[model samples]
Target chain A: MNRRQFLSWLRRLAKTAAAGVVGLAGSRWLRAGFLGAEAAPPAQRPIRPPGALPEARFRAACTRCLLCGEVCSAMCIAFPSRIEGSQPPLRRAPGAMERQELAPPVWRGDDTPYILPWKRACNLCMRCGEVCPTGALRPIAVDRQTIAREVRMGVALIDRKVCLPWTRTSWCGACLTACPYRQRAITVDHQGRPTVHPEHCVGCGLCVEVCPLRYKAIAVDPPFAPDRGAVRAE
Target chain B: MILRGWLSRRRRRWPGGARKVQVLRRTLQLLVLALLFAIPTLSLYDNLRNQRDEVGIQSRWDTRLVHRLVADLEEPKALTQAVRGSVWTFKAGELVISDPLAVVDFVAASRVPWDRFLITALLPVLLSLLLGRVFCGWLCPADLLFELAGKARNWAGIKTDVTFSRGTKTAVLAAGVVAAVILGNQVFAEIYPPRIVGAELYLWITFGTFGAGAWFFLALIAFEIFVSRRFWCRYVCPGGALYALLGRYRLLRLEVDPVACTECRLCNVSCELGLDPMGGRFGQDCNNCGLCVRACGHDALNWRLGLPPSGGVDRLGHPESGVAAATPGEPAP
Candidate 1:
């Protein structure tokens, strides 16, 4: 190569090296924004669609295609960061707090799907899993047995403090009526008090939707959450 | 053999008819764009119809057309069940096709074994190796959008000649890999234009709202229109960089005819990625999009298979001697 050509080539190489260095350093900084230290609390964890990989893997696995959300028959699945009509970000369901107050990792999951039960609970139709290209949500069969055995989004916890029947505030069996598993997942006692079978509960949140209390008497705790049957004792 | 003879005869009859490749490309682009919207729309319709049937809510929306259309298909399962995902990870039936860059990102970030993606990633890998970034030229939704942005800018009488080093995107690709490995996230996928475009369309069609990615797409368009020309694809796209690298020793490539020579430089201007076809500078960056072939008034540019001649120590491997040796009228090199 000629002297001028060699000099230009050297200049180009330096520029490329500089760019690579900048990109590497910038990406490290950008990673801080892309993911946070694993500090997200259990209760605050959004109920994932049925057959989802555990939270950590799901975050990495999901391409954020939102195909799962697209094919959702019940339309219960919602993206956490959807901006509607130029307004401020919509508030999540009653139990979920303002996004800013949440842990950083929870905010990082903004692109993924979450089932907010108070707004719309998953009917456990198994459609989301069917369309998920990534194995983030493993496709499960539509049969009752498969769903009962495999789908464990969470367990339904009925709070006696607010439950109308449990408090003897005039016989409310709304949860039992709404439960998809009926007597299997939730049962009504002779005194008309309702009991939740956590093992049987697929946590579809149908009971949470039907609960008449302003503060829902029934809540689905994600399976990974600590102390699954804490409410059963109370 | 019969088809080849007939095609040659047709080519002789209408020399300019070779531009049919451009027509085919545009048609494919439109079809892909339509399917991008239609896939989500079909899913939304199915979701709604299923809801109506089970919940017994008498809805006012119409489903007859979609229902009949799907029912008429050879396999309705192909559209709804099998045809899932964007170009990032397209699953058409059992053959799951994933973008090569996404496969790389997933491997680096997830620490998953290559076997996990072997079946899913086979098609795109093979395609890039053979056709050489044909996705960018013939299929990418972003390519279509950026071309339109160029036209719109021209119509507005706006001109911006800003360009960046071609190596910049390779650096960006390197940076993204480093980031993904360190952060355990597909960081580039968030900013990658085609994925963003497909996802934003799906998001809007299904949910009636755009994510923050929509703004990033719009910003890219605006930047292309006002500040730079084909900036993202030419300089920033990690996917494009990855494809360029994979397709570096690609079997298919553009070859310039020295015998039919007139260095008009029109082909250089025609290249969307700012390649120099007239000067015989077609490199891995050349997508073999064939726009330069159509642009040459002299019909000098041709799609040649295999490598261009490795003539001496010439940097570009310019095939002037090879072309001269092949042509009857030229003196043997």
Candidate 2:
């Protein structure tokens, strides 16, 4: 191309780049200001799959290759569909909404993988971490002790009101039997009431999945800051 | 025999160096696509075996030809793990090849891993500087889709002259990088069409399903086919925009020789990017695909080093004027 045409192209490119920078920065500022004001405190922190880095660092590092999700044997790792609280109206038939609700809450996490234990609990295969391209999930070995020590996926919380043994409805030991750690992580009292040993539990959610209660008697609460202060069981 | 007949027909139609270059480029694109497919296919086999072993079930397909061909190769499985990503991979504890724009976002948002960044990001940048957006022409799977879309558009007899400003891509690149920084993620890489294509293909091969990212890629393809031609690459792709910027001063470029000039304007029509090659006015948008060079029956358009010929009368005996050379209907340079 002629020199003047080339020069004009360069000028136009620079102008476009400048416009882009300004437009993006301005839009982001507006979004942050507007969204930040109305944003509610998250109801619960989602359980990141084992070996995940801290939330912020994980967000920054993950390229969303989805390899982790693909390799997950339990298929517990799920990508969040949309931003939190912006759930799209279910477009299925009229009666399908109830079925949708029963099918698991639409995870509001980012495209990063998180386990929904009630649906499918992680078996501690550790394949997701090994295949993770970014260090968002650190590769760890698939041993029980290593997982228990290193993987603090979440802390399991049992609701005594809902638990069959605790509520004096029917004696049940499903959670204890399903616990990979069995006697170490979960044990039954003399009355056949199950008690969780938080220190020994890796929170893989096997028990949560196995719980036969219509609404799970045991739930895995993701490692939230304030919750860490309370020692439920020694 | 039918394939050989078609090949002979194609050879008769193009019949030259440009045809050879096109063939080579197509082969390279296919090779890249196959290489991407290989990674997930191997991983799927290994994953399946691991799962089967966990349950003590033996998969009967272990003896199949496809399995033997893809999984039996020990090196590829090891290599797949070592290079477990598209557009960017962490190999041997170092970031191997990364899209330049993603690197920019990573650096802008957080501390750069200097050593990995150099090899992953700068290497691609340096190659673009030398070769000029050759990746778009040779390696990008999206280009193959776009080409197919172009063919479909022609087959459907849809004539569109919709042209967008070249500056739009630069703006997109700028916006994407800034957004990535603000979002604190490689958002561009996540949605980049080529990367998405590779990832989706991998996911489909492994899991028998596509991810949400596949929808974005499908949308891009649909837009290209129905709305505008090559719109993603021309107007919106940040990766292409980054490559274009790096390729601005590329050493290798299309140079029109003023000697043997036929003002046929075939080259102009042949240009998918709408560059006026007959007037010797290929700007930054020219991907150097050599299509125009091949289309020129007079052998006037050819690859040359440095800039186009400057300050001279055209072979058509018109005064070589600045910028005016690009005016349509002007005699060919």
Q: Which ten residues in a row have the lowest lDDT in candidate 1 chain B?
A: B54-63
Give residue B17's error in model 1 in angstroms. 3.3
Model 2 Cα shift for residue B5 (angstroms) = 11
TM-scores, chain A, per candidate: 0.67, 0.66
Candidate 1 lDDT tens digits, A1-234: 999999988977886687589769966754443232222212323578999876667766776767688778788887755221221112232322342243233443346788867567888889888877667788999999999878888767666766798788888888888888999999999999998877688888888778887766677766442232343223
| Candidate 2: tens digits of C-alpha lDDT, residues B1-333 | 989998988677554788788888889888878767766655555555555542322343422434555555666445435545554442333455666765666665554455244456667788888877888888887788788878867655566646687778888778877787786766676667887777667655543445566667767766776678888877778888788777766778776666676677899888876667776566556677888887888888788786533554342212367634543356333
Interface RMSD for all numbered candidates: 7.8, 9.7
| Over 4 Å off, model 1 | A1-45, A82-105, A108-110, A141-146, A158-170, A189-197, A213-215, A223-234, B1-15, B53-64, B68-82, B308-333
TM-score for each of the candidates: 0.76, 0.73
